[model samples]
Target: MRPTSEAELSAVISDATGPLNLRGGGTRLMGPFAGNVLETSGLAGISLYEPGALTMVAYAGTPLAQIEAALKSENQRLAFEPPDLRDVLGTSGVSTIGGVAASNASGPRRISVGACRDFMLGVRFVDGAGAVVKNGGRVMKNVTGYDLVKLMSGAHGTLGVLSEVSLKVLPDVEMQLCLRIEGLDATQSVEAMSAALGSPFEVTGAARGVDGSVVLRIEGFEVSVRYRATQLQSVLARFGAIDLIDDQERCANIWRDIRDARAFASGDGDLWRISVKPSDAPHVLETIGRNKATLDWGGGLIWCEVAKGLDIRAKMRVAGHATLMRASNETFAKLGRFHPEAAPLAKISANLRARFDPRGLLNPGLMGAAI
Candidate 1:
C-alpha cells in the first residue's frame, strides 16, 4: 500500500483489518514484519522551510539525502546529526527523514547536542485507529500536553504511521578539529574521553578506534577550534602521541563510519548496540567476551560485533539496555531483539502501546513479544 497524501493514508489505514508492515526508505526494515506491506515513500515533499529560523517540516518519506542537501545549501543541518543507516544496515535504500526519527538515530555529535528526539519540534501521524494525530509545533518552544512527538521518536512505527515531521536545525560550524591520541586501551580511552568531555573545551565527538586509538572532536569558529585543540593537546598529552586529523575530508571519513557503526557492518556476526555508562564500558565489554567493538557517544554507546546466539542481556549487568542492531531472522527470533523492560516500565509501556495501537496491528512484531 502506498499513501501519496495524508487523507488517502487515513482511508487505507481505516479500512485495513490486519497489521501493516510500515516501510520507510527500507534502510531499517529489520526483524519480522507481518500481514501486508505499507510503503510511506509516496508521502513526499517539504511543506515548510524556514532557513533563517533553522526549522524544517517535511513529509515522512522524504529522502534524508534531499533534506540534508537542502540544509547544506542553507549552511544548516539537523542538530542531532542523524545516521545514514543504509550502509550499516547493509541495504541500498536511501535513508528517509522519517526513518531517522522513528529509530531516533543520532551520530557522534549527539554527545554534544542531543539525539533526534531533542530536535523534534512536531509530528503528524496516523494512529492504529486510523485517526490523524498532531503533536508539538513547528517552533522550538512548544508547550503542548503529552509530548507525542517524543513518544513516537523511537517507537519504531508500533504506534503510528508518521506522515510529517518538523525539526530544529543547527548552523554548520565554521571549523572542526580532531585530536587523535594513540595507544590507549579501551578503558584508558574511555577515561581519556571522560576527561575530554568533562573539560571546558567543547568536544563534539569522542570514540575509541578498534586499534585502541582515541579520537576527540571539537568544532566552532576557526580560531576557537584551533585554540581549543591546542588546549586539549596540552591537557591530553599524557595519553601519548597526539596527532591531528583536522582536514575536513579525513575527519569526515573517520567520523562517518563511527557515526553509523559501519566498521562492524560487513560481517555476519550479530551486532549489538549497548547503551551503558561511560565508566562501565570495560566491564560491559568484558561481559560481552571482549568482542571487537567501537565506543561512541563519549563511551555511553558501545557497538560490538559478536558471534550469534550470545546472550548479551544476561551478562550485561550495567544500568542500561542492549539493542540487537543486526542479525538473522533465526537469531532474532531465538534471542529476541530489544532488552526486556523492567516490570514497572513494562506496565507503563503496555499502557502506552494500548493507547496508541489498541489492535496491535502496526508493525506488531518488530519490537518482539517483550515490548
Candidate 2:
C-alpha cells in the first residue's frame, strides 16, 4: 500500500485490519517484518522553502537529496548533518526526509550542534486510529504546548506515520579544516577529543577511526579556521604527531567516512552502536575486545563490529545503551533492535504506544512486542 496524501494515508490506516509495515525510502530496514508493505514514497515533493528564514517544509517521502540541493543553493544546510547509511547497511534506495526524521539520524557534527529532533519545528502525522494530527508549526515560537514534533522524531514510526515535516536550517560554513592526530590509544584519543571539545576553539567534529587516528574539525571563516587550527595544534601537541588537512575535498571525505562508519561496511559480522559517556569509552572498548570499532561524537558513540549473535549488553559494565544497527534477520529477532528499557520506562513506552496506536497495527513488533 502506498499513500499519496495525508487523507489517503489516514484512510489506509483506518481500514487496515492487519499490521502495516511502514516504509520511507527503505534504506534503513531493520529486519523481516510480518505485514503488508505500506510505502510512503508516493507522497513526495517540497511544500515550502524560505531561504531567508532558514526553514523548509517537505512531504514525508521527499527525497533527501532534493532538500539538500535546495538548501545548498541558498548557502544553508541541515545543521544536524544526517548520515547516509546505505553503504553500511547494504541497502540501495534514495533516502527520504521522513525516514531521516523517523530514525533521527545524525552525523559527526552532533557533537557541536544537536540531533535531528532539535531542528524539527513541526510535524504532521497520522495516528493509528486513522486521525490526522498536527503539532507545532513552521516557526519555533508557534510550537507551543505538547511538543509532539520532537516526540515523533526517533520514534521509528511506531507511534504514527509522518506525513510532513518542518525543519530549521543553518547557513553553510565558509571554511573547514581537520586536525589529525595519529598513534593515540583509546584513552589518549578520548582525552584529546575532550580537550579539543572543551576548549574555546569551537570544534565542530571529533572522531577516532578504527586505525586509531583522531581528527578534530573546526569550521567558520577561513581566518577563524586557520587561527583555531594553530591554537589546537599547540594544545594537542602532547598527544602525538599532528597533521592539518586544509584540502576541502579530503576533509569532507574523511568526515564522511566517520559519519557513516565506513570502516565496518565491508566486514562480515553484526554491527552494534553503543552510546556512553566519553570517559567510559575506553572501558566499553576494552569490554568488547578485538572487535573493529570506530568512535564518533567525541568518543560518546562507538560503532563496533562483533561476531554474529554476540550480545554485548550482557558484558557491558558501564552506564550506556547499545543498539543493534546491522545484523541478519535471525540475530535481530533473537536480540531485538533497541536496547531494553528499564521496567518503569518500558511501561511508559507501552502506554504511549497504546495511546497512539490502539489497534496495534502499525509496524508491530518492529521495536518490541506489540501492545
Scored by CA lDDT, what does every candidate get? 0.86, 0.92
Worst 10 residues of 1 by lDDT: 362-371
| Candidate 2 per-residue lDDT over residues 1-371, each given as its tens digit | 98898999999999998998989998985787888889888889999999889899999999999999999999999888999999989999889999999989999999899999989999999999999999999887996788899889999899999999999999999989999999989999999999999999999999999999999999999998999999999999998789999999999999989888899889889999999999999999999999999899999999999999999899788989999989999988888888998888888888889999999988888765797
What tens-digit string does per-residue lDDT give for candidate 1 at 162-208?
99999999899897888898878778899899989999999999998
- Compute the lDDT of residue 4 as modeled in candidate 2: 91
List candidate 1 segments past 4 Å from native.
368-371
User: What are the models' TM-scores?
Assistant: 0.97, 0.99
Q: What is the lDDT of residue 266 in candidate 1?
A: 76
Most lDDT-accurate candidate: 2
